[model samples]
Target chain A: MTPRVRVPETGYNFAYLDEATKRMIRRALLKAVAIPGYQVPFAAREMPMPYGWGTGGVQVTAAILGRNDVLKVIDQGSDDTTNAVSIRAFFARTAGVAVTTRTRDATVIQTRHRIPEAPLAEGQVLVYQVPIPEPLRFLEPRETETRQLHALAEYGPMHVKLYEDIARHGHIATTYAYPVEVAGRYVMDPSPTPKFDNPKMDDCPALQLFGAGREKRIYAVPPYTRVRSLDFEDHPFRVQHFDRPCALCGAGDVYLDEVLTDDAGGRMFVCSDTDHCEARREAGHRGEGA
Target chain B: MALARGFADPVHDAQGAFRAMLDALARPGLVQALPAALAPPAPLTSELAAIALALADADAPVWLDGPLAEAPEVEEFLRFHTGARLVADPAEAAFALVADPEACPDFSAFAQGSPAYPDRSTTLVLAVRHLAAGEGLAFEGPGIRGRVRLGVAPLPAGFAARWSANHALFPRGIDLLLAAPGRVAGLPRTARLLEA
Candidate 1:
């Protein structure tokens, strides 16, 4: 195990970004929390990293980060992924805060494309990196019209899109970045998280924040807020199903990733949440692969 | 009057206060404790002072009501600490400090924001006598799991009716932070105040 890093007295401001920037982001965050699911426009600062690489999530995390917070970063549910490791190390050097891989130990989790499998408690915060904050941007393609649609609660077009999917694909084919109605008011884009994670957001105890760097938008779903996925009466919303348990952890009803082993197409389905799998393995849960 | 000291450690302390405020707002009806060391002027509790120090800045204008507005020390303390622009009109404020909740302005008096941008509305930081857990008013909405009971003393008159109207605005309405001596509770526009 690595030694815990201490917060340095010199170098950058507490969290790398200056106090003014943090204040700006903090004000925006307050507004975001006030109106759940409503996209609040903010002045996105240019971080050290490039766009499309979790800058928005980094900003949000930096704004809320404190010396005592146990920070965790995950990319596609894996703590060792390049994105996650870089962010974790970035904060470690910049803020000098303690970093953890355990889901339960973390007070703030900055995630890209997945929520941790463990249930978050009341005080924990989940920040998501959003590439596109607007759920209707691709459909309407007009910022003015989309804002108007959100104002009027005009989500019929979203249902129609789902209906069209059912007509062609025999099911609602929105696999990722699935749209959800927050508090029955605003139609929000829940980042690129798989539809399987949608249900986990409803009535969740943890505060959920979404930030889109390139889009310059920030939104939130407060703890215990009702987050309902868009669906039809005949074609109800459903998550992707797996026929087998995780090859490594023997965990069922969890999102899995398929890894090819042999040249002739031999593959094994494993849990996408790496920490969850490793924890289960440590707890003596064995599977065929183990 | 001498200017009171702000957060001992500006960055970390503000971060802690912001987290407390965030948690309070995220979990409506749940009381979160603020940094207690802050000693602002009378009528301005430490919780509200910490919130103003953490969230209110030059970009965000603040409005005070009743005793808070009358007390020059309170205004000076806020301006000296947070550097927030104090405004006269409540509608123009991004944050409103209500020292006297009983005589505070109605929800409609503050900025309700427009249909296009509801987040632009004002957030009220009301100083209440106390916050307790009891068979008080029932609240159900976002941030609330099923239902939660909150007891706020000396609320504005016709609070239920005013809250109902504020809630009816849906995406456009004011949010509130009830500040007690050491704790604060949030009442976002999404939370509905059930009548007795």
Candidate 2:
């Protein structure tokens, strides 16, 4: 008698995406990597979740996730947030893959709004959930016009927008979703990550993949690629700095979030990255709250 | 000729190959190993066949070069496994398979996608006798950190000149995947060959 094959309880294909869909996404991913920062259009498939809830990142992770890969998902730098926990559970249930909150242990990380605080190695892949893949979308609005601009290497409008911000506020007021030039060829939006995380992207060892599901676009920044934030010679691009260290772990030089203690007008700033803060605390780091 | 087999476990195997291919392309000049289970016909290396199986599909039309085009069994194997359409014109192909890199056409002969959509161009998978790291051509570009050397034996004549022309077409040119016996290396259009 032949041996019986045990099927998954969910009855869904591995990673919840069919083989053909995975193939199509893989092809688009190759093209996206080939032409760094150039948005490649793909046939976006609807997922069980909503669009704003990182459908694009989920698809990219599903297509690239192998049986041995250790997956990690984060939203706004926190691993235990509702979005992050849901995504982690989704992959664990469907693909039956290992999930970790530690950045170093993860082989594939699906992120929204922020890159991890820890440095990524060469073998790791970073998938960003991008809401807008085009830097010129808000400026040009017309797809045809933006395509022409990108083809001609016309980035004057982007600079003008920054210049306008400088004219009004005496400095560039734009913070998140800063525009960057990839490999000195195409101007791209590095998702909604804050300008504070922009420097981390330059010469990053990990391969960075960006996906925008509603827009049906995918782009990439290959490992060690040049990603320069837009700035003028006199007024250079700068990252946000904190006046004090994290109240929870006493960590410095990391993005922080403000937390209100009570109605007694007391507030404390803590590390936005939960894993980083916890690791630091375990290593004997202490703060006022700790 | 007996029909060959594809991946033993199609889903996981293809995923593994795709990750390797992704790493190979993302880090240009780096050699990545493909799954060793595919038994393709002659003139098609296991690495190349693995890439085709992982990427090519009914929507992706493939163009086979002289050596591969002449082999009827190769076509049957690819069709049976990947179901990719075979096209004669290089410009119409989404992916091109080349067994003889020495006689392969210039990069201009293939589809250099328009400025609007550069990703629409063809990706060439060339089967070479040797792919390794030595005192070969140095590459510098997006994926490369400073510089890296890659030695691909039996490359086409005037390869530097041809690559220069191809690289000149920023965001609009053909990418290359050089497959040796068990490993493959990528040469995206962005990677520039530093003259010796």
Candidate 3:
């Protein structure tokens, strides 16, 4: 047999979650898929690691990863980012799965902040880290009350909050982490990505899963889940940007991460989604000292 | 140095830990072993840490008091693994883990539920040597539907009276887990304790 070939005890598919855990997770996954955007409360387990720092994604990957899956983990949309690298290293040791940097090459991608620039294909999974699963949580303090609000489909407070923002700041000053109503089902927190990424959530083909370790909540968006940004009709929803091309890739269509290089306030904006930008660069691309 | 990228997770990933915890809580005064165990402190066994770790994360602000309060190892362990926030006051905490309940902060100091919504109450993790099992507290209430005797080791000073006050608060009071080395007995705020 080849060096990589293994037996049952040592061969735990990609991630090391047991079959029972995978079965339980699979049941939850079905519900999430059926519900679209509702935050389904789950019993998040303790990994070798603690909560917060990717327990949610870890569990998801553990349950979903099969023997031949290629796993890619990214933080802030970059594979090189510290947290992303750490998670990658963790899976390499525990799950023994092949890791990839290119978005298209991997079957599953776990991401924080920026989403992939390249459109994800069907069958590819995208997981997100959710700080707070309840979009109405900031407005409502109690879980029971929030559950009632969801049951009633009462979203007056969210509209009021967005309207108030528009009333105060010109053009909806909220940058990232904008809220979206999924498929008219449940209002979901699209992780903490700047509102700029909000537009990317609409009508996606790949599966989107969100996990909140601390809050004990998890939710999902199946392919084609209609994600409407929570905004007033008068003000409408807005994406944040300078309307400029990427400094590094000279790509005008991509989301840029505005970076401050010095104390004198010289600013440079690079593509926030590195995978897309790098792919573009590899195809014989150049930019303005970007 | 562990990096924390709370990337997206499947819906069920978060549910596994929660279901186990809820099961543990529902069975009040029963022990539940966690899927993932960890190195814990003297008072905190692997089981306690596992429960705490599963429930407590960065989103869930945690408060510690008494012996385990602010211990660097514990704090570091939580931060590294879960990215759970450590709060100074008991009132802000979602889960309050105490080494010794007797020397712990006042139960009233913690966040109790308001009349409008009683589930806003905090869940307390009280570590004791042994729970006086099978005989002390005459547990009565919604889940129990009748009286069941529960024995606990000597509680912290005035614990019974304080818990009585907690019970008096009903859904407004804090939930509790009287934990020991490897086992724990859960008591949600809804449970009422009568003399066995």
Off by over 4 Å in 2: A1-9
Largest lDDT belongs to which candidate? 2
Report the C-alpha lDDT of model 2 over A125-148, residue by residue, as the tens digit.
Answer: 999998888899989999999999
lDDT of 3 by residue, A188-237 (tens): 78988877777777767676877776776667775555688887677778
DockQ of each: 0.78, 0.91, 0.02
Better of 2 and 3 by DockQ: 2
Of the candidates shown, which would achieve the greatest DockQ relative to the real structure?
Answer: 2
Q: Per-residue alpha-carbon lDDT of model 1 for A148-251, expressed as tens digits?
A: 99989999899888889989989989999999999877889999999999999998999999888889998999988889998878888899999999999899
User: Which residue pairs does candidate 1 place in steric collision?
Assistant: none
TM-score of 2: 0.97
lDDT of 3 by residue, B33-125 (tens): 434334554445554565455556655678877666646767766666556798888888877887777787778988885643344456787
Give per-candidate clash totals.
0, 0, 29
Each candidate: what lDDT? 0.89, 0.90, 0.67
> Least lDDT summed over 10 consecutive residues: which range in candidate 2 chain B?
B34-43
TM-score of predicted chain B versus true chain B for each candidate = 0.96, 0.96, 0.82
Candidate 3 — which residues are off by over 4 angstroms? A1-14, A262-264, B1-196
